[model samples]
Target: MTESDIITAVNEVFCEEFEVPLKELTPESQIFDDLGLDSLDVVDLIVALQKKFGVQVRNDERVREVRTLQDLYDLLEVIKREQTSA
Candidate 1:
């Protein structure tokens, strides 16, 4: 999938799973501050993202570093590249 596809899919997951407004989702949007997701909600988000991308990111150290929507998009891109290369 292209980067655009990844961004769209991730945004869709947030909209569907967390009821976040589409207008609120942007690359710079903070997942916790802007999106109103708490620690517990983040765990749910991680699960949703794993299911959406079909990738195991919950145990990945990089997950803890994600703070913005751009961060997530970048992380997924990296994961996708690593998977394909492997």
Candidate 2:
């Protein structure tokens, strides 16, 4: 998958999961601060991303590094690359 694909999927998941508008979703948007999502929502977001991308979204220290939409897009790209290569 491409970066745009990841961005689209992330936006879709956030919009559906958090009831947020598409216009508000941007690369710079912070998932927690901008979207007003709490810790529990982050767990759900990880689960949703893993299911959608069929990649392991591990609940580890790296997960905490996901702050902005760009971070998530980068994560998804890396996951996709690693999974496909594996």
Candidate 3:
């Protein structure tokens, strides 16, 4: 899938989990500030993404890297590229 496609799917997961409207989502949206997602919610999102994408996104450092929607998109892009190449 394309980067946009991956982001779209991820947004769907976010919208569902956060109960936020799709129109409200933006790349700059902060995981905690804008979406009101707590740390547990963030962890749940990571699990959801891993389950849906079949990608392993573990490691404290990597988890700390995703602060915004754009960060998640960029990370997903990297994983997508790696998966395609594999």
Candidate 4:
């Protein structure tokens, strides 16, 4: 998938899984502060993302570094590239 596709899919997962408004999901939107997702919510978010992208991210160390919507998109893109190359 293209980068644009990844962004859209990631946003959709947040919207569908978390009930976050589509209008509030920007590149700079803080997943916790802006989206109101707490620690437990993050687990659900990760599960939803893994199901949506068909990738294993639950144990990925880089997941700890994600802070914004853009971060999640970038991470997914990197994972996609790594999977394809492997």
Separately for all candidates shown, the number of backbone clashes (residues 3 or more apart, or on different chains) is 0, 0, 0, 0
Question: In model 3, which regions exceed 4 Å deviation?
Answer: none
Tell me the whole-model lDDT of each prediction, alpha carbons only: 0.93, 0.86, 0.82, 0.93
Question: Taking the tens digit of each residue's C-alpha lDDT, what string does model 3 give over 1-86?
Answer: 88889889888887776678898789999988888888888788888888878888765366687888999898888886777799
lDDT of 2 by residue, 1-86 (tens): 87888889989998887779999899999989998889988888888888888888875466778889898898889878987999
What's the lDDT for residue 56 in model 4? 91
Order of the predicted models by lDDT, top scorer first: 1, 4, 2, 3
Put down candidate 1 lDDT per residue, 1-86, tens digits, no spaces. Answer: 99999999999999999888999998999988999999999999989988998998988999899999999999999998999889
For every candidate structure, what is the RMSD over all alpha carbons to the true structure, in angstroms?
0.6, 1.1, 1.5, 0.6
Q: Name the lDDT value of residue 79 in candidate 2.
A: 74
Clash pairs for candidate 4? none
* Top model number, lDDT: 1
Which of 2 and 4 is the better model by TM-score? 4
